[model samples]
Target: MKLNAKGALLHRQLYVLLKEQIVTGRYRAGDLLPTQEALCQQFSISRITVRRALADLGEDSFIQNRQGVGAFVTANIGKTKHGPDFSFIGEMRRALKETTMQLLLLETQRCPAAIAAALGLADHEQALHVVRTRSQADEPVALLDGWIPCRFAKAVTAEALKTKSLHELIAGSFEQLGRVAQEVNAALADPIVAQALNIEINSATLKIDRLVHNREGAPVHYVTVLTAPMRTRLVMEVAADDIDGYNVGRLLHDVQQPKAPRRRQP
Candidate 1:
């Protein structure tokens, strides 16, 4: 396959292309793949590179190679496609059957400086503080800390929080709830957060901060989330147009055709 020079290594690119085809059912189980020589000639790659790609596929359980024969598709790993809705709260709710939320703290307290700024609160202003831990399949996954202005405090209760997600409570109580401004970053877990998630201190974690706004553009809540990287992964699917200059067809075609050989000097 033709490899994109600006992208991953030639072998890696070839592996990904073949993997996609197998996973998408273009190549079914028990179907033998093209010979090594045929693959090399079709992709304009070296035998070593083709072998490496095939080896990786075999290791991943996507294919199996028989001596004196060729590699055959052994398994099909199907992927679940998701749409634009990337609501964290929605994800938690859908997995409620296997997930549990433990409310650690819920009370009115003076908002911290950083959280106060995010919620547009004056210094020392009162805010409702909520801390919780979420677990899936009995493994701790995330630690959530939320701060909402005292105006909405009356609508929240320990019992309500235990049953409903924060977003649910907020939306139910306020008619003006609108968009949420969210930011995600890679951070190291502190001692407290690490202990809560059952991870080692200083381990990598995904930190997400969100500022919920009302229809009138007023900030209503600020939330911080620390999640175990192994247990929590974030996936987003966007349209080709949403990603500037991303041509899916061209990418696939590039890997399907052989690169033209360079002309010799006259």
Candidate 2:
């Protein structure tokens, strides 16, 4: 690819060139782009220039950077279909009877800085924290952490969380819980997540962040769910109709009867 680096617009030119390759199907979906060093050599640009271009592409959702791995074209590129979003609890049950939850940690405490910001908690506000390991057929799949405002803390308990979907629980107690806004990204597996999910450090983890809202357009809860890329698939169809409104988290799988949670590994 020939890149223009005249004056002070080299990075912008590189960004456009890479984006063109992606849009024109030259790179295609999920194709890893050349490494920064390779790009630097090919385009005769500095590392900073290549980094800037890649950052812009990633932020635009044209590419995803896998930690310890090179950047890749987004899998969603050029697709014309989107999936209907549904509650994970319901979807998990419908997809596999073998799916179960192992409660890791559930507590009520003051929101941490990051959690507070995501959930829009006030200063000194309390939030309910629920951590669980989700699995199917005794095989671990995901690590989930949900934070809800303290205003609703009294309504949720460890026992109450044991059997039903969190969506159903919130809808029953609250008046107008509605759609959720979510973003998915790739991240390195941290020590806690790696240990709980039985994966290695720097392993590929699909990080999903969600902001649940009530019907009044008010944000009610914020959740972060991390899963192994190998164990889970993220599929969404793209279309003009999708732009109007579409569910983004529906899992495409077989429905079956619910089963029991498995014992922990010794």
Candidate 3:
């Protein structure tokens, strides 16, 4: 494996990559990692850099390093399980059938500071923003605020949103919709969100942020989804090898009070 010159982040990047390998069973539990010299030469990095990366892996409960025997994946690194393909698109299609959608707002305008940054738009650049609510059995369950780059705005319309997901419409212009970086946490419903979701102001809610990239890894769409805490639940079928899912499951934190959901540029 080769690593690019990322300066200070190079070590941290290496740490994360190695951690992923272990978590995915590429380097299964009890498997010995390459020696420092071997890793240095393989990655074309310095010996010190390799040492730091390995040290971090050991500290993270992913591996154990012997004095001179090199590093080995921890015996209890993670629990592995088998499962079927739970394609996200398929899940969305199921939701489309189960839940009804109402498009509340759809317009192309100058992007907000946070929205522009998340969608990789320049200063004052325009984007299509959509606000919609999802309901099941006549009960509002989710309020979604989404922003898309102007280039993809053509494929998105008020009517299209009621039928197709944002990702589906946007992918028409690209080879494929690639990876999505998502985060979920506790948040409080704000005035606008509370009213849209038919919940009381300051009510607890679950906030989800998803940044989707094109096949080339350029941001295309960013969305924030808020669900009434009492009416909705986030569920994931996770195994040790599902690194991203496992991490998401472990990171849910309890909050002391309701707070407005914060937007972040990934």
Candidate 4:
């Protein structure tokens, strides 16, 4: 409600606002959009502006308008979240187990300097750069941008990724992955990520920096995961008796599981 239409044209502003709502599941498939009169009141715009916005939505395959009746979200709204040509998502739903993955890019390229260093690659070493989006029930939750040294990239084919998580693939291809150094940080979604996750540009995101090493302690896989902050929560559990490594994490959820109550201090 009350979308600021001063910067851009009012109609275009409404179009983007409504589109974002649809993508975020506010107005789902088969849902009836408000009438022109209602939209006019909500955004303080004229009925003509509302019509223009709705017309643009129609042109973008987001809605089907009728002469007397109002517009309705099309049944194919799932594809509309990204665009019309996203029909391949349906195949991904069936091919992947537990969660669906849309492999956007999979190619071998020379690693970037920072990433190459993380993967322990010398200068000019090529690595497999893989980009994918993970979705649950057709809603994208995370984007995985990863790099793998060419030595182990042979098993990371497009077909192979559809069936396994990147970690699983790394474990299968390479023997005895020794340890993983991972840290979580906060970031903002850029244009590329905003488009991929159907979120607003500069939206808050949870970023994960991950480095995997083999038993010999050579870095093998390097990846960064960007997840929608509102869509996910990270839970880490450590047994009461096993308080070994790092302790920087604060208490989020406290679960008490003990044999009996401890004696009260005098």
Candidate 5:
């Protein structure tokens, strides 16, 4: 109802209001929300203002807009978790049992400049970049892009790649996967990913940037995992020691990947 600095109506604020209600369970999932016209008239604002507020809600997966129908509350709003790795691959499977994975393209190539930085490598250093599409049931869910330093790449075969655990492959090759650092945030799916996932160009997804280390505490791998939002949720649990040790520095709040058998959707 209030106008923000841009002299535009404060849709983000209004979005928060509606979102809070849903999160608190006041407005149950599948409950129909006020129509654009009704909201505009109620707030004494223009339809554009109402639309903006609704769009903000839609963007965050707080609600769904049905064409020619009405906007309905979504069941997947606050259920998403932003936390530590705590086993990301397993968390994803628990969130969506219908998950499946297929190697879109896998080959050995010199790591690109961008990829090198991602993997913490020197220029001209060789690494293997494996690209694959992960789906939930039949729908594409995420694009798993992994960069493995060549030293460890030899351990990962095409057959091995088809399995569920890249972490296992790395751990098997080396002695252990001592530590891992990851960053998770919201991002728009790029064109290639959008097309492959059958989502919009700017569709929101969960992006996980990760780096793995060996027991000697040497950085061994870097990866970026992008996943679909609607059908997937992320979960993380923190231990008390992690808090006392100030381990929460680079381990800031939040939560990727595909491996394992394909399960039929229930």
Candidate 6:
């Protein structure tokens, strides 16, 4: 691996490479990681940089560092038994059988600025907000917060939310469930969320943000879901043909071409 002078980039590169190795089973759980000096020589980086990368891996619960001894893999990364598929449509279909939702809060309130924008609502517009905890086999696994426009708020009720997934409720209210845009990000749980999930404060969590559109392509609702890392794993399956449609050949050609520098203004 080549080490760049850029400190942050260099650190991240080493971390990602080691993480990939561990996740791909090249370095199995309980396997000892290379010593700091060895890693430094392999990457041609300083001990400080190696330590920084290792620290990040430790914080994320991928490895454990022992004083005088080397770091060892703590958990089996990329391995889960019957984990929920990361696709929204797939997960919703499995929700009723695999999990249950307990309604925590249901009320009409002024939508938060960020959520309002996602739902295509004017600033300060009132919206229906619902909060619930999703559990599997009686163990809390996720916390969901959803916001829908006031026009459709009346249709959602506490009783209904307990028996149905948010998507199911939304689908019943809309003519069609149009395209859904989703983003998954890594985050640490705040105090309130940590307590709700019965996990330690600042524990690793997955934050999924979704925006649903109606049949006419109008925004329908915005949702944010938080899940503990230990209890949930997100997986996405894509076919080879689907990957080929990305036009990687064209992208590689564009990447190989150099760009001319823009002329400076007088």
Q: Give the higher-TM-score candidate: 1 or 3.
A: 3
lDDT-wise, the better of 1 and 6 is 6
TM-score of each: 0.56, 0.55, 0.57, 0.55, 0.64, 0.61
Q: lDDT of all predictions, in order shown?
A: 0.78, 0.76, 0.80, 0.78, 0.72, 0.79
Best by TM-score: 5
Query: lDDT score, residue 3, model 5?
Result: 41
Cα lDDT tens digits, model 3, 161-180, are 76677777888733488777
Better of 3 and 5 by lDDT: 3
Error of 3 at 186 (Å): 1.7
lDDT of 6: 0.79
lDDT of 4 by residue, 52-166 (tens): 9999999988889988988998777744322222222233233355467899999899988999988888888899999989888788988989999988776778887666656
Q: On a 0 to 1 TM-score scale, where does candidate 6 land against the true structure?
A: 0.61
- CA RMSD, predictions in order: 11.6, 17.7, 18.3, 11.7, 13.5, 6.9
Rank by lDDT, descending? 3, 6, 1, 4, 2, 5
- Tell me which residue pairs clash in candidate 1: 1-43
- Candidate 2, which segments miss by more than 4 Å at Cα? 1-98, 173-176, 237-239, 242-266
Give candidate 6 regions above 4 Å deviation: 1-80, 83-87, 173-175, 238-266
Model 5 C-alpha RMSD vs. true structure (Å) is 13.5
Model 1's TM-score against the true structure:
0.56
In model 4, where do residues sit more than 4 Å from their true spots?
1-97, 173-175, 239-266
In model 5, the worst 10-residue window by lDDT is 249-258
lDDT per residue as tens, model 1, 136-241: 7689988989998988666688887767667667666334577666777889989999889998788779998878887777787798989976557666544656
Candidates 3 and 5 compared: the better one by TM-score is: 5
Tens digits of per-residue lDDT for model 6, 1-266: 66886644677779878987887678988999999999998989999989999999999889999988889998657574676565656677687678877888888889889888888889968898888888997889999888989776655787766666566676673336887767778888999899778887877799988788877787777988899876776676665675653322222232566789999999
Error of 1 at 247 (Å): 20
